[model samples]
Target: MPGTIAFVGDSLTAAGRWDEWLPEFTVSNHAAGGATTADVLAEVDVVLANRPDAYVLLIGTNDLAWRKSVEHVVRNVESILATVHKHEPSTRMLVQSVLPREPEFAASIRDINRHLWQYSSTVRAQFLDLWPVLADENGALSPVHSEDGLHLTAAGYELWLDALRPAIERLFAVPTTTTPIDVLSDAISVSGLR
Candidate 1:
């Protein structure tokens, strides 16, 4: 049996709809519109409670959209990661880079993602970059992959599904096999599980 995979993020990850992309694994989504890093921390409990084997996290567009400080955003993300560690240590979390915003907001989004990727590199979990697949030569979100300047359209989601396919495939081979919900229960008993 394979472990359950869950996606926990803001609109981009949620909008891409991972379910439509990978049909092989059991998947659950905890994405919501207008969610910032703080919002993510607020709802993370729901995701941990489900305890999927893997988690894909994309957030912070709203935070940048609101002109929140970079330090504040990073702090919130650090908090979220810490929570994930304490509650579900066994669950491997993917820290997804924040997508480039439209013309006006692109720079800040890039800054936020830069920090996220850097943090992911140093952390125990993984940081998956959705930037290249979604960005055009100008470093703006490609029109083909976006519904608006932000959310992904169908083609955009297809591109996302493809970019993440390898990671999803790797989930099947994880030695510990169980339904995602059960895995969380088992994970809770271990130390360092957030």
Candidate 2:
């Protein structure tokens, strides 16, 4: 069974009905519309207080919108992850790629995503590359996914959920006994046999 989860990001995250969508787990949305990485850093403590079993992060786009350098966004994100890891080493983390926007932002977004993917490994977090699923041939947020090329439509959210659900499940999945002896022991216990 899934445990508590915290979703942290900007408008894209703030708009999600995570509790309704992920009824299996306790959900907390710590996102705010127009929020930048610095903004997330300021309010990260509130999210930590929830003590969620996992964290799903999706920031940086707003920072891009504000013309913040890729390094600025990446550094802030690293700080967020480091702070969370320091406070809750056992908590799992899922770092999502910054969704595509206008074509001009595509390259920078990819750079941010790559850095985040690498950084996630350092913090032992899983990275979800949403680009292939969300971007169009021109490397912009597909119109099918977003009307404004930034926020998602219902269909977009559906695609995201399709990817996100499995990742979350894997993050919380209990390891099964693979050894023959352990399997036999489990079977015996289940069958009420000595």
Candidate 3:
């Protein structure tokens, strides 16, 4: 069966050619350049309205560049996940870590990724840590992958695609099943979303 997937985030996601990269699925790119986590949170309903079988989120780097606190970004992301899970409990979700950038922002980015990983688990969303593949020894975005230290090069996108494709396949391979309403409600409550 063909599945629909929505990509939501900032420029990194906006720049992807998902249709070409993953042609088996219907792809919707809701990402925009310069977007922050707050931006995605604001328009989450629009993304949800697509009713995709799965969602791929790659946000938060822009927020870091704008100097937003790590907690602020994490909270906004948590709200986004809670909102999606509330509306589409059966949908699969993959939250990619904020990619490495300038060295100065590495620590904060790592902090946000850690929170995202933990929170994604709580919400039953899979988290992809891009650091191992995209970060240099100094923990900055690798120059081979990005010339501007912010945006990715062709090589970077290829690496990203390599990491992402298998995860999506795994998501698709799983048979879809409905969670009982009581269990779903409990998960939402335990997730700390109001």
Candidate 4:
């Protein structure tokens, strides 16, 4: 009962080796480094063309980094969801909160995440708050988790994979008894499942 799942976003999503992490499923990583929501929107047709069973969206930090207002980022994200829904109504969508950045941008990231959490309800998508797991006590990306404070370290990706595993299991109806290592044996050879 394996299903195809796609990850769409900026470097955070692009950088994950999802096929290795979620070996039970066919994963497509459509993320690109430095991609903003607008960039995603532009290429969404290609994404929907793949017709994945589920999509994990994690863009918008770049937009904020570019100094776009929260409202702008939220609107673009809402549109992204809407576009997905319009093109692929049955696709299970997971809208992840924009991960916290340097301390200077923490406030804006928090604000954007709040709006995204609220907006997910409108599109029937689940919003995943990655802040608690990825951010340090000061609400900045943990040095232990990231070297550049933007891209993830091995520990960071491990944390992300842990948070993501159950959500994917729930979406795909995978049983808890199916261990990740076991799933690895079931892995399919997809060339671009980054």
Least well predicted 10-residue stretch by lDDT in candidate 2: 174-183
Instruction: Report the lDDT tens digits of candidate 3 across residue range 88-177.
Output: 777888999999999999899999999999999777788888989899987888888999999999999999999998888877776553
lDDT of 2 at 15: 96
Query: Model 4, range 1-194, lDDT digits (tens) per residue?
Result: 58888899998998898998878889999999999989998988999899888888999889978999888898999999888866676787889989978888888889999999988877668788899989997788888899998889999999988888876666556222223332444463344443
Count of steric clashes across candidates, in order? 8, 0, 0, 0
Tens digit per residue, CA lDDT, model 1, 29-79 = 888878888888898888888878787787887898888988888889877
As for candidate 4, its clashing pairs are none
The positional error of residue 189 in candidate 2, measured at the CA in angstroms, is 44
- lDDT preference between candidates 1 and 2, better one: 2
List TM-scores for all candidates, in order.
0.81, 0.88, 0.91, 0.86
Which residue pairs collide in model 3, if any?
none
Which stretches in model 4 have alpha-carbon errors above 4 Å? 173-194
lDDT of 2 at 152: 95
Candidate scoring better on lDDT of 3 and 4 = 3
Off by over 4 Å in 1: 170-194
Residue 154 lDDT, candidate 2, scale 0-100: 99
Candidate 3 Cα errors over 4 Å, as ranges: 175-194
Ranking by lDDT: 3, 2, 4, 1
